[model samples]
Target: MEWNAPGEWTPAAAAEPGQPRKGILLIHGLGDSPWTFVDIAAELSKRGYLVRTILLPGHGTRPEDVMYVTADDWRQVVRQQADAMRRDVDTLYLGGFSTGANLALEYAYDHADVAGLVLFSPGFKSLSLDWLAPALAVT
Candidate 1:
């Protein structure tokens, strides 16, 4: 529950570092942290990709942090992480789950140079917009 605990959101590297050919920016779902993407980031790292599951503004910390965060704050975090990763690799890819997927989509849409995307369980119309409106507004 504490920030940066074991298996928590902190950038990691492969056992044997390799040339950074591809980069993957992993994002977790709403109310979730980067722990979920650890394994995937490792696998991608081993495959010669620079992978990092960043700590979004409201994530990797106490849940209450989310209330003071906004969509723009989250987007800025992704942009900063993505920019750093992109500088070290050839191709950049965005991968995310749920709201993270929405962030990825928005980033990809704005940056046509993004190599590709890998979304997991992206939120669509099935998600309750009415219920989410209040949550989003507080941020």
Candidate 2:
């Protein structure tokens, strides 16, 4: 679990004492670990963003841990982490990969204060073969 553990990155101090800080909370997808965001977190940190990555409930541990996890479990973790991050930064962003992206979307829907979202490979729904009609027509 060493490599899969959650991590955080802090940006350099603000130029002015009263300047507001910007932060992002990244959630890893199902069957994935926080390591998925290591590179991106480093890049964002370099760009003056306070970045954090969380180990989703039932993740970063035994594979059996996910058996009892539910969507509500993940949602609660996201809500708690977001609230905590908001306390330290003036602007907050949520980012996610795969299933995590779906969770982020749901959170943003009810929380208007979220500054923005960065989603990658969102897992909103299963891909439909029906959408292939246009691509088949081109060929």
Residues 33-100, model 1: lDDT tens digits: 78778778767766666677766777666778888878999999889988987786678899999999
The lDDT of model 1 is: 0.77
Residue 92 CA error for candidate 1 (Å)? Answer: 0.4
Top model number, lDDT: 2
Per-candidate TM equals 0.78, 0.86
lDDT of 2 at 30: 92
C-alpha lDDT of residue 62 in model 1 = 75
Instruction: Judge candidate 1 at residue 95 and give its lDDT.
Output: 92
Off-target runs (Cα >4 Å) in candidate 2 are: 14-16, 127-139
TM-score of candidate 2 against the unseen true structure? 0.86
Q: Candidate 2, which ten residues in sequence have the lowest lDDT sum?
A: 130-139
State the lDDT of candidate 2 residue by residue for 1-139, as single tens digits: 7568889998776455876799999999999999999999999988888999998888878887886788899999999999999998999999999988999999999999999999999967776885875677522
| Among all candidates shown, the one with the greatest TM-score | 2
